[model samples]
Target: MVISTHKMVDCTSPVDAARLFNAFCIDNHNFMPKALPDFIKSVDVLHGESGTVGSIKQINYPEGRPYKYAKNRVDEIDVDKFYCKFTAEGDVILGNIEYAVYESTFEPLESGTHYTMVVHYHTKGDYVVKEDQVAVSKEHMKNMFDIASEYLVTNPQLYALKQ
Candidate 1:
């Protein structure tokens, strides 16, 4: 088995950290499909409660996409600190990859939110992850963040932080 790790720390969103965190890590099941209907079909909780640790979710993609669905299990989450960690498997990691672990952190900033993402890819047997695969994954992650940020910016009251 081979493991590859990638980290991206310079991403920033115009939305506030709490709101972005709510949309991405906590309420993604409701927010993602609504924000990007053509890309994401739906997110269903398969086990445990949504937004909680140990919960597993199945993210379904729209037709014509490369993959149909992917299952992700929430390994850790901290609402107060705006941190979350999850592991993705199933169709998303088919072929040479065993699974991929993702960790995200949203830090509040004066202008917006500073976002960071780390991904750990575990490959099957002696297979090594290619640069193109990592590039594609990073692009997908950035697109998701951009889409969600735009949606939240347009609808400010959607995921507003509570007092």
Candidate 2:
């Protein structure tokens, strides 16, 4: 087996950390599909309660996408700190990967939030994950974050109550 880790940092958002975290991490299951209908079909809890540690969620993608669905298990969550860690597997791994662990954080700044994500990919056998593959994954995540940020900016009251 081979393990590869990639870190993406300094992604800035003009939104508050709490609000952005609330929408992106805490309420993503409810908000993602609504924000990006063409990309995400739905997110359903398969085990445990939603938003809690040890919970498993199945994220379904729309038809014609490269992946059909992915299952993620929440490993850690700290609402106060706007941090979350989860392990993803299933179709999203594309067979070559056993699973991927993702850690994300949204830190408050003077004018916005500083976002970061670290992904640890465990590949099957001796297969090594390439940089370009990681780049594509990072780009997809960035696009999603940008869209979510734009949605929050447009509807300022959307996740304000969650904070």
Candidate 3:
């Protein structure tokens, strides 16, 4: 139960690359990741009901971090091209989470726009692996897609909103 999928592309627009990947996953509180010492109280959607789709959010897990109650479910929403697919339940980050899909695709690249990003997740655990563990879990999914494509390219305004 270890499935990892990550992809990235950019120039922008599937609605500004799905609103910069949904504001880099709900405005990650500056993100540090190491058990979050000083801060990192990110994740807030609270009750989504806008634009389109089933739109439902209520994720706020940062009590102590590490697989806390992370709720998410906006199954599939397609705004002409931009997309949002999710299916998180409780304990996130390598728990029984499945069907975590976030997608985008926009093309018009002669000098700009050409975004594409995807993440599909499915994993549950009891634990029991020996042989190489799928090449160290695909090198930790290429270091989590190179730290999420270097935090979406060094935080493009944390997914742009500067019009």
Off by over 4 Å in 2: 161-163
* Tens-digit per-residue lDDT, 1-163, candidate 1: 9998887444998899989998888888999999989879999989998889999999999999888999999999999999999999888677888999999999999989999999888988998887766777678778877887899999999888667
> Which residue pairs clash in candidate 3?
none
What value does the lDDT take at residue 12 in candidate 3? Answer: 42
| Residue 82 displacement (Å), model 2 | 0.7
Give per-residue CA lDDT, model 2, range 1-163, as digits (tens): 8998888544999999988888877788999999888879999989988779999999999999998999999999999999999999988788688999999999999998999999889998999988887777778888888988888899899888653
Worst 10 residues of 3 by lDDT: 31-40
For TM-score, candidate 2 versus 3, the one ahead is 2
Quote each prediction's TM-score.
Answer: 0.94, 0.94, 0.26
As a whole number from 0 to 100, the lDDT of residue 71 in candidate 3 is 57
lDDT string, candidate 3, 1-163, tens digits: 6655655333343234444444433333233232232223444455565333555454454566565555565666555554555565654545354445555454444433455555556555633333353454445434543455456565555556567
Task: Provide C-alpha RMSD values for all models, in order.
Answer: 1.4, 1.5, 15.5
lDDT of 1: 0.88
Q: In candidate 1, which residue pairs clash?
A: none
